[model samples]
Target: MDDRRLTDWMEGYVRAWNSNDPADIQALFTEDAVYLTEPYAEPWQGRNAIVRGWLEIKDEPGQTTFRWEPLAVEGDLHLVQGRTEYRIDPPRSYRNLWAIRLDGDGRCFEFTEWWMKEPLPE
Candidate 1:
């Protein structure tokens, strides 16, 4: 996918993260989308499962902020580097890598994420 399409989809992802609305989450994926919280984990398969899985473990609205940059695009595969900072006592942060495959319609058909907690302040 092109940068513009990827940017639009990323924006939708941030919106979905902030909203946790079923429709918002559903709009980002295809009907048969696969979403993995980690590369090796079993994925949330299909739109309904994805929506249900997300809501079950969702972050509260406005609980965190995310920033990401596109790293690569080869065919339909996209890679992103990201940071997530949670708004909670003592604070928390993570470094994230995402692999996404978007459909022609710019909705993600497959997604996997890898993340590490940022080192705590000494």
Candidate 2:
């Protein structure tokens, strides 16, 4: 996988996420995709499920956005460190580490997200 292309794809993902359009987000993945969330959270498999998962959260009563900070790239994997902030009613956030793996076609195959529900500073 081309690292530069993967970076671009990641950027497009953030853009799509900010759009709050699940279809846009889902378009970034392959037909058979796997998204693994933190412990206890069910993983989303396949494009259809992934699209549904994103749609369910798009209209949530919060201003949420994700920012990806690339940590490193090794082969087809990208180690990213990022945070997601959501202002539901009161401001809150989840700081996370994302391990994203892309296939040779620059399509995302695996997305492993690990985050903690933490209080926003007063």
Candidate 3:
């Protein structure tokens, strides 16, 4: 995908996260997509399962903010570095790296994310 399309996709992803709407989540992936929360874990396979898994850990709407930058793109694979801040009583943040593979239709078929908690500022 081109830079503009990637940017638009990421923007939609953030919007979907904030919306927490099932339809929104479903639109991001292909029917047989696989979503991995970590490197070795079993992926949430298929759109139905991905949607279910997402809801299981659903973030409250407008409760989190994300900033992401595209690192590289090779063929259908796109790499990104992102930071997420959860607005809560005790705010939390994470450093995230994502490898996403988009299908011809621009829907992700494989998505993997590696994340670590960000240390609180002194």
Candidate 4:
């Protein structure tokens, strides 16, 4: 997909993240989508499961800030490099890479997130 399409999807994703609304989360993916929180971990398959899984570990609204830039695009696959910084006390941060595959309808059919925590200060 193109940068604009991916950006729109990313915006929707962040909006969903902030809202923790099932409909918002559900809209970002397709019916048969597969969502992998890590490369080698079990996936939340299908829209219903994805919604449930996301809610189970949902982060509170305004709990974090996120920024991202496009990394690459190969046909339907898009990659993004991002940073997430939590706003709570004893703050935390992470670097992220998201590999997203979208269907013709512009909804993600497969999404895998790779992330690493930043080392805390002494």
Candidate 5:
């Protein structure tokens, strides 16, 4: 994908996360997409499953802040590194690495992420 397309997609991802809207989430993926929350876990397959899985762990709208930068793009795959900050009682942050593969229509067919919680300061 081109840089503009990638930027638009990432922005949409952040919007979808904050909105937690089922339609927003569904719009990002294909009907038979696969979403892997972690490397070792079973992926949430298909749009319906993906929507259900996302809602199960859904964050409240406007509860988190996210920043992401494109790392690379090769063929249909796009790699990105991101940081997410949660504004809870005790704030928390996570660093994320994502590998996303987009179909011809710009919907993701496969997505995987590795997220690490930031250690508290001493």
Candidate 6:
């Protein structure tokens, strides 16, 4: 797949996330895609689990926005950095490291996100 298409697909995925629609979020992945968060947490496997995981975040309090910056692209692999803002009165921000693998047909097969957020120092 071309980098342009991959970037566009990634943008669509982020749009789905921003929409907070569980089905839209799950549409980014393949049927058996694996999504791992951190190390020990049981990785969400398959589309159903991914949809459930996203449902937990849908309709969460506060305004959330995401900004994606492409880092590197090699063949079907894409690395990107993302900034997420949880716009509470105090506002919270998260930095995310994302590795995305795209299939030959331009669909994503796996996406792993690593992120860190420190509480707004109260």
Where does the lowest 10-residue lDDT sum fall in candidate 3? 1-10
Candidates' C-alpha lDDT: 0.92, 0.79, 0.89, 0.94, 0.90, 0.79
User: Which pairs clash (backbone N, Cα, C closer than 3 Å) in model 6?
Assistant: none
Worst 10 residues of 2 by lDDT: 57-66
**Judged by TM-score, which candidate is best?**
4
lDDT by residue (tens digit), candidate 4, 1-122: 34777988999999999999999999999999999997677899999999999999999999999999998999999999999999888999999999999877789999999999999989
- Per-residue CA lDDT of model 6 for 1-122, tens digit only, reads 34776777777787776676766776688889887867788888888888888777564633787888888889878998888888777888899998888877666778788999956876
For each candidate in turn, the TM-score is: 0.95, 0.82, 0.94, 0.95, 0.95, 0.84
Candidate 4 regions exceeding 4 Å error are none
- Compose the digit string of candidate 1's lDDT tens values, residues 12-118: 99999999999999999999999999756789999999999999999999899999999999888999999999999889999999999998899999999999999
What lDDT does model 5 reach? 0.90
lDDT tens digits by residue: candidate 3, 61-114 = 989889998999998899999999999978999999999998777889999999
Better of 4 and 5 by lDDT: 4
Give candidate 6 regions above 4 Å deviation.
59-62, 118-122
- Better structure of 2 and 4 per TM-score: 4
List ranges where model 5 is wrong by over 4 Å.
Answer: none
Per-residue lDDT tens digits for candidate 2, residues 49-110, read 88888777664533787776778888878988878888677877888888888888888899
Residue 39, model 1: lDDT of 56
CA displacement after TM-score superposition, residue 49 of candidate 3 (Å) = 0.3
Worst 10 residues of 1 by lDDT: 1-10
Q: Which residue runs does candidate 2 get wrong by more than 4 Å?
A: 59-62
Query: How well does model 1 score by local distance difference test?
Result: 0.92
Model 1: how far residue 47 lies from native, Å: 0.6
